[model samples]
Target: MKQRNILISGLSLVLMTSVSSVAMAQCTATGTAAGFAPQYAPFAVGGALNTLVSSINAANTAFLTQSTAFVGSPANPKPDQEGGGIWARGIGGEINTKNTVSSTYALGGNGSTFQPVATPLTGGVNCNTTTNLQFAGTQVGTDMARLNWNGWNVHMGSMAGYLGARARDTTAATPGINAGGSLSNSLEVPFVGAYAAATYGSFFIDGQIRWDFYQNTINDPIQNGLFNQKIDARGLAFTANAGYNFQLGNNWFIEPSAGIVISQVKVDPLRATGTLLLTGAGSIPNTTTFSNIESYLARLSVRVGTTIVSDKMIWQPFVTASVYHDFAGAAKAAYSESNNPAFEALSFPLIQGNLTANNLGTYGQFALGIAGQVAGTGWLGYLRADYRTGDRIEGYSLNGGLRYQFTPDML
Candidate 1:
C-alpha cells in the first residue's frame, strides 16, 4: 500500500516534467529572430537532419531501456518467463527542438546606391545575421514485438512520423531602405524508419534505418520579390548500437553503450527569382538551378546508465547519460548567378558558398524513467523524461508506453 503511494507520486512528477518540457520546446520553435537568408540558406540541410536524428534517438532509447530492466538477472530468471516468451509493446510520444544558423553579409558595394533610392541610405547594411529555425511535432509513435528463446532475445519495431519548422521575418531591414519587408521561410519533412535488436546473455546489439523526404521554401517580399527559392530533398540515415550489462549486488545493475549514426542527403533545386534584393527596374531571371547539392553527417556517442529495483511493487527506476561527437560531413552550396541588370550595375558577382556541418560539438543528454509490473496481470507500464543540450539541436521529450508479457506458462 505505502509502496504503491510512492510509485504514484513518482509517476506524477515525471508526467509534470514531461508536459513542461514539451511546452518549452513549442515556445522556442515559434519565436522570431534576425534574417540572413542569402548566407544561411545553404545550411538548412544540417538543421533538418539534426532534428530528425534527435527525435528518433530519444524515442528508441526510452523503450529499449525499459525492456532491459524488465529482463532482470539471467542467472536466476523467473521460471514463468524461462523457457520462452513473447511480449508486445506500443509507445506514443513527442519531441521538440530548435535549429539556428548564422552568417555575415555585405551589400556588395554601397547600400546607398539603390535606384529610386529613398533618403539615400548611409554606409549600406553590412553586418552579421543569425536566423533561429525552430522545429516541433507530436507524432513520434512506435510499435514493437519481442521474442525470447533460451537466453537470447530479439525485437523488431517500426516508427513513422512528421515534424516541421517555419520562420518568417518582417523586421529585418538595412535601416530605412527596405522597411516593412517580410521573409517567409519554411521547412517540412516526413520520415519512416525500422529497427531491430538482439540480446544474448549480457550483450546487446541494435540497428535502425530511416528515410526522410523534405521540402523547403524561402521568399523575400523585398527587392522586386526576387531571390525566392524552393528546394526538395531526400535523405537516408543509418545507425548501430552495442552495449554490455554488469550486475552489482542483487538489486542494482549498470550498462555502458556506444553507437554511431550517419546520414546522406541530396537536394533538388527549383527555379529561383533574382540573386539579392534588387528593384523592379532590374530584369528578374525566370529560373535558377544548383548542381551537386549533396551533403552528409556522421556522429558517435557513448552512454552509461543504471537501474534501481524497489523492495515493493516490483518497481524499477533508471537514469542514463550520454556524450556524443560529430566526426565529419560538411556541404557546399552551388554557385548562383542572375542576368538581372542590378547584378551588373551593382557589380555583384555570382554567390558561391559552403555549409559547415553543425558538428554539435560534444553534446550530452540525460533521461529518467520508471517501469514495473501491474499487480496481477502480465501488463507492464513505463514513463520517461529526456533532456538534451550542448548541440545545435536541443530537445525535450516525454514518453509513455505499455507492454504485455506472454509468460512461458501462458504459452
Candidate 2:
C-alpha cells in the first residue's frame, strides 16, 4: 500500500509540473524597431550550456558496482603485484570484475525547448541539453586474482566529437527575443580518471576521480555562421559507490547500491560575436559568457538477476530500479553589445535578468540488461536499455559495450 501511494504521488507531481511549465504567456510587440531584443537572443544558449556542463560533471549510474555477484565465480583475493604475468592494468592497480575496455553511445533528449523558466525576468527562456552522448573507456588491471581486497585500475574515456541538438524559441514565447528563431548546438566532452575497489565478503566499495573538458557552440544559421556563439566549461569530479549482494537460492541474486558524484566546474570568460537576426538591415556586436557552476548527483539502485553458465560461456540477465537527485540548475550569464556608430543608439539594457534550465531536482530511472562472457577467456560484453522519468523531464538511454580482462576463473 505504501509503494502504491508513492507511485501515485510521483505521477501527480510530474503531471502538474508539465502543465504549469509549457503554458507561456504570449509576448506583445510594442516597440517599432528591434531595440534590446537582438542582443538578448543568445541567452537561451546560456541555459543549455549550463545543462551540458552539469550532466558531464555528474556520475549517476550504479548498476555495475556489484562486482562480486557473478554466479559460479566466487570472490577471489586481490592479484599479487610480484606474482607477475602480463599486467593489463599495471602493477600499481590490479583488475577485479570492474576492469574492462568498451565503448557505448546514448541518444535522447531532456524534454524539449518549450520548457519553462524558473522566474519571469526579461521575457522567458526554456533550456535543456540532452540530445546524445558517446563514451569509450579503457581500464587496465592485473591477472593474479589475489586482488580480494587490494585491486585498483586506471580508467580513461572521451566523447571527442559529440552530436548536436536543436533548440526553438519564438519572440512570442520569450517576449524580447526574435519572433522566430532556431538554434543549433554542438558540444564536446572528454574525461579521464582512475578508480580503486575493496571487497569484504559479499560487500564492495569503489571510488573514482575524473577530469573533464567541455566546449560547446550554438549556431544561428540566419544570422552569423559557425562559431559566432561559444560556451566554455571545464572541471573535475569525485565519485564513490558501495554495494552488497544477497544470494536467493540457485543462480538468482539481489543487489542494492548507492553512489554520489560531486563536481566542480569553472566557466572561462567567453568573448564571442553575433549579428542582428531580428532586423536584417543592421549589425549589433554582442558578448556572451556564464558564471562558474558547481553540482552534485546522488543515485540509489537495486538490481535482480539470474545467471547461466556453461563450460565455454556465461550469460546473465538483470533488471534495475534507480533514482537520481541532481542539484545543478541555476544558469547565470552576462551579455552586452556596442551599437554601430551609424546605427540607432541602444535604448535598453541588453544584459537582462537571469536565465535558467530544467536540470535540477530528483528523477527516476529503470533499466533492463544482459551480459555475456566466454568462460575462462578474458572477453565479455553487455547491452542495456534505460528509461528516465521525472518532473518536467523524460528520456531514454541505450548502451552496449565489450570488455577484455587479463585473467578469469570458472566453476
**Top TM-score prediction, candidate number:** 2
Candidate 2 structure quality by residue, lDDT tens digits, 299-347: 7888777777767766777788888786765545554444333223333
Residue-by-residue lDDT tens digits, candidate 1, 75-165: 2233323322233333333333333322222222222233232331112112212223344433332333343456555555665556465
Count of steric clashes across candidates, in order: 1, 12
Q: Cα miss at 43, model 2 (Å)?
A: 3.5
**Model 2 / residue 57 / CA error / Å:** 7.1
TM-score of 2: 0.64
